[model samples]
Target: MLGCIWQYFYSSFLRFWLKWFLRHITGKCELQRICAGYKQGALRTSQIGKNCNKIIILTLLRFEEDVVDCVAQIMRHKNISEQKDPMFKVNLQQCLLQISGYNTLFAAVEDLRKEVFDSENEDHEKICGDLLMPSEKLESRITKQWGNIGFQGDDPKTDFRGMGMLGLVNLNNCGCAFQCRYSYAIVGINLTEMAYSLLRSGALKTHFYNTVAGKPEMQNFHQLYCYLAYEFNKFWVDEEPESIMEFNTYREKFHDKVKVYLQEPEVALILKLDAKN
Candidate 1:
């Protein structure tokens, strides 16, 4: 009876550890195979490789602080009129730092433009066609789209959480020469979707390992078996949130629970009580 109880507890502990290891590497719960479709496109394409060459060149040239300041000024003028666009602003700042480290920024921007436009068109022509227009016409379009503006939903001017509008332009100007590749975009989108799933699934608890052991001869076999069974069943259970603000209000709850189980008195007491009762 004692041998069976020890075996059961040991097996349960091993399973818990295995699940924790899986969750850690896989980034929470098992994500759907949403990236399979894009994997071939991402790996087989030469577009990103070609664009990366320009990116490297631009990275080298834009290393100067003065050049970074100049680029930041340009970004501020072109993409950052409002204060609400923090993500755009942050990405622009990071790009400026990357550019300021090397002389490659200019080449990257040129390469990026080349990728975006047909070879038959000049860089100026391509930029004008895609991004710039007559001031009056631009103003008229803005007026029409004013109600559709702001940081919510799928406005092209601020879509993908404003990274599309602000980061794209600022990074391009700062010497990032890569156009959006289909595979890379798909990978990013799929990764975010998986992360959201893990967050919603309450799989966080399964990512922790716990173990208990005691003197073999003194163990109460029947009580130990029941306790191990309870722990094993509880391992897969999703915890309930008491309020909408529980994440914030109970910020340390997981850590605290772990601490209670792992600390001196609690761990021994739990085992002792299980053996006694």
Candidate 2:
């Protein structure tokens, strides 16, 4: 029966259709699981000083049964002929969701190093060295930090835009006491743009920006000014302010105008405008 269904659906068009249907049902949950597991492992390591090996072994053991169940269900009920199968698709979705959740947890824990380690201690050096080691590396720290979890969204022609702003901001604040790769600055700018889009879409309205924007207009304007001051302090860190600065300034101005639409200052404002052309 399975073979018959497979044969019927294995044609190019049918296969493509089935693949997307399955993915749509399963993808979000899968991503959430992976991110959560990642966070749990990192939190355990940071808070309890647990070794990475133990964390990995224990995490796998805990989730092994769920993984097996998902695989079994997929093998038993997956219908190649059907574009949507609740049993197979749902189980697979759960498995992937668990993985994504783990990953998100790991990232949160990893970013807590400032609290976990002494800035001046050699322990900081050893810890980072161990984490960055080839075997210990989890899903490419740089890529993951830049929000590179693989997923295909509605746009068939493009991959889902990864965690851009939130990830980059976390990375910027990591303070790992080493010269990070130069590529990060470039990637950070790109991620900022992606984050801005998400923000505009209202997806991240409850996040950091929203928190700042939550206050009354006068208070929000004050908070925005403070944030702008911090950004200026690090302006030289990226050298070229063409991308980050422009958008940041625009946001600041927009917020100010929101507070008082017709207010004007005496000084001429030098706006480093984004090159939209």
Candidate 3:
């Protein structure tokens, strides 16, 4: 109860006066101080974003192309002088770009998720083929050979139900990128779901903000999937669950571990395919 009252008091009155006092002494607004003090990435960006007007942030989220204008507006509103602090403009612009780019990437990913996987589509066929059997051709589209890569049934198409083409794309990217010890396609699809959950919940912001300075692309998302695929395999090996049936339990444990990593300001969940130190 006291914490809640203190928070209310701070936001309602103390915060404004605190900022005013800081600006009076430092001759720098809160945003400028944040940009100057914190290094690039989520550490800087998240603080600047939190202090920004909600309306302006919403505009940037919708039209990432307007980030320059958004930053200019923020500078003007905050009474920041570019002549005195030249780097402030550049730093704040980069933060806005990273913030907006994440939203754009999520929208792009959602579009792919909504797209149904077409069996006759040559591009789709090729991606799946390259994933499951890069060295040879399938006897037929519906052949049981898909089981070799860990599809649950003779047909792989049905497996793309909830995730749609997003699952296939992630699966293909993971398969082409690494050698798997688990049921490859099944694990890839499962990891795709994991990736989607992380993206939707905004848990990926820390990783993306650290890695991509500007707009994050679909390829960035693919790289994240690869990271999860590789790390999860390593995790599975270390845990050595009784069988695949215990996947959910171990998967949740791994998810919690990754979440803990994300909480760190310097988190960058990249895949390093090498022997451990």
The numbered model that scores best in lDDT is: 3
If the candidates were sorted by their TM-score against the true structure, best first, what order would they fall in?
A: 3, 2, 1
Worst 10 residues of 2 by lDDT: 151-160
Question: Which portions of model 2 show Cα errors greater than 4 Å?
Answer: 1-65, 70-114, 123-277
Q: Clash number for model 3?
A: 0
Off by over 4 Å in 1: 1-64, 99-277
In lDDT terms, how accurate is model 2?
0.34
- 1-277, model 1: which lDDT tens digit per residue? 9999888987779766865686577543211111111122212111222222344334443444644455355445444432543344343333333323212422332333234323244653334224432232333422443222221222223322322222223322321111221112212222223222321242211111112111111122222222332332233134555532443333244334533443332232132224523
User: Per-residue lDDT of 106-163 in model 2, one digit per residue for the tens?
Assistant: 3443333223333244554334334323244434323343222211222111221243
Residues 134-172, model 3: lDDT tens digits: 887899878888888888998898898889999998877
TM-score versus the correct structure, for each prediction: 0.16, 0.23, 0.95
- Candidate with better TM-score, 1 vs 3: 3
Candidate with best TM-score: 3
| Candidates, ranked, lDDT | 3, 2, 1
